[model samples]
Target: MKVFTYSEARQKLSTVLDLARSEEVIIKRRGGEVFKVMFKKATPSSPFDVPGVKTNATTKDILDAVHDSRARKLGI
Candidate 1:
């Protein structure tokens, strides 16, 4: 963990953020107000991130459905 004054944090914002990626950063104001910075855990990407019509449809089935809908809309 690292501690920095408010002015230091403002001047070295980028460095503070880079360090925060690995550890916690504490900022202390002149009037004793303090804050901490930390990184949130990243979420892993998934192919099924879409929301709607939850079915056991395969990828090909979904693609075909989308194509058919678009064709209808375009009068093709």
Candidate 2:
């Protein structure tokens, strides 16, 4: 993913920090759109890859699945 444009990433900001350490630089602008620059993907902390936080469903399992989908759409 290498798009760049904002004046070619401000005139090659050090080759976009060395292609954002591996890959992912987008940037755009001279017309608008495009983005990504990197970083932001560090959450998973156990329960084997976070299967919905290893199935624990709290907050009363999201208000019991929003009160059982508003009591099955009112048909209680």
Candidate 3:
């Protein structure tokens, strides 16, 4: 962990960011306000990142069922 004053952090923003990636970087203000900088891990993007549905219905089966229900409701 490292500590830097607000002005020091502002002057060495790049170094502070690099240090933050590996460890904690704290910045203190003249008025006694303190802040910590840390890196956030990003989630990997996926096409199949959907909620789970417990059903055995296929896509075509679902479409056919919808069409049948609509036709029956319309009496056609």
TM-score of each candidate structure, all chains considered together = 0.54, 0.26, 0.56
- Give the Å shift of residue 14 in candidate 2: 3.7
Question: Candidate 2: what lDDT?
Answer: 0.83
Alpha-carbon error at 59 in model 2, in Å?
Answer: 72
Q: Name the candidate that leads on lDDT.
A: 3
Per-residue lDDT over 1-76 for candidate 3, one digit per residue giving the tens place of the 0 to 100 score: 9999999999999999999999999999999999999988766578777668899999999999999999999999
> Which tens-of-lDDT digit does each residue in 13-75 have in candidate 1?
999999999998999999999999998866658877655686899999989999999999999
Can you tell me which runs of candidate 2 are displaced by over 4 Å? 1-5, 35-76
User: How big is the positional error of residue 21 in model 2, measured in Å on the Cα after superposition?
Assistant: 5.1
Ranking by TM-score: 3, 1, 2
Candidate number that wins on lDDT, 2 or 3 = 3
TM-score of 1: 0.54
Off by over 4 Å in 1: 42-76
Name the best candidate (by TM-score): 3
Lowest lDDT 10-residue stretch of candidate 2? 47-56
Cα error, candidate 2, residue 30 (Å): 3.3
**RMSD, each candidate, Å?**
8.0, 13.0, 8.3
Indicate the residue-level lDDT of 66 in model 1. Answer: 100
Q: In candidate 3, residue 4 scores what lDDT?
A: 99
